[model samples]
Target: MSEKDQRIQTGKFGEDAACDYLIEADYKIVERNWRCRSGEIDIIADDAGRLVFIEVRTRKTGGRFGTAAESVDRRKQQQVRDTAQVYLRSIGCSAESIRFDVIAITMSRQMDSILEYKHYEGAF
Candidate 1:
């Protein structure tokens, strides 16, 4: 596969893992891969009555680049927040009912296995 295809596949895997993790943690999965002209949200779930907008970042464990969470910079956070706002407006929900979260998945490059799942709440 091409490099871009590999990246996309890896991202899909990470999103799947994140959804499972959230479900295991008692979070109800409301949506996945919600997108608009502005941006995309990897996951949208309900966490104990609070609307949660989640961003999933995945990277190979011990990669030279950086940790998955570290990939989410200020500009990315702003984009997520903006997308979340559009989502809320479409659903007729108040922004007060929502929270931003990040799920970082690290994969072992050697075995292509998930090494860790880190959940960051209220990340933005």
Candidate 2:
């Protein structure tokens, strides 16, 4: 597989893991990979009646590049917020409680196992 393909595969694995984790934590998975002209949301779930927009970042190796959570900078956060707003407008949800979350998955390059999983609520 090409480098891009490998990256995509790793991302898919991460997302699957995140979904399982969220479900175990009592979050209802409303949607996955919701996209628009603004951007894409990795996951959209309901956490105890609060709407959560989640971003998943996966990295097999983290060193000089930084942890997966740290990769979500201000610009990316803005993109997520923009996309979330578009989603809310489309659904006509004005009074919903919302939160931004980041799920960072780190994989072991050699063993291909998860090394770390961190979920940050209201990261932005």
Instruction: Report, for every candidate in turn, its global Cα lDDT versus the true structure.
Output: 0.92, 0.93
Score residue 111 of candidate 2 by CA lDDT. Answer: 29
Q: Per-residue lDDT for 1-124 in model 1, tens only?
A: 8979878988999999899899999999999999998999999999999999999998977778789999999999999989998999999988887899999999887536898889999998
In model 2, the Cα lDDT at residue 81 comes to 95
Clashing pairs in 1: none
Instruction: Give the lDDT of residue 84 in candidate 1.
Output: 90
RMSD, one per candidate, in order: 1.1, 1.3
Q: Give stretches of model 1 more than 4 Å off.
A: none
Q: Lowest summed-lDDT stretch of 10 residues in model 2? A: 58-67
C-alpha lDDT of candidate 1 relative to the true structure? 0.92
Against the hidden reference, what TM-scores do the models get?
Answer: 0.95, 0.95
Q: What is the per-residue lDDT of model 2 for residues 42-79, given as tens digits with 9 covering 90 to 100?
A: 99999999999999999986556889998999999999
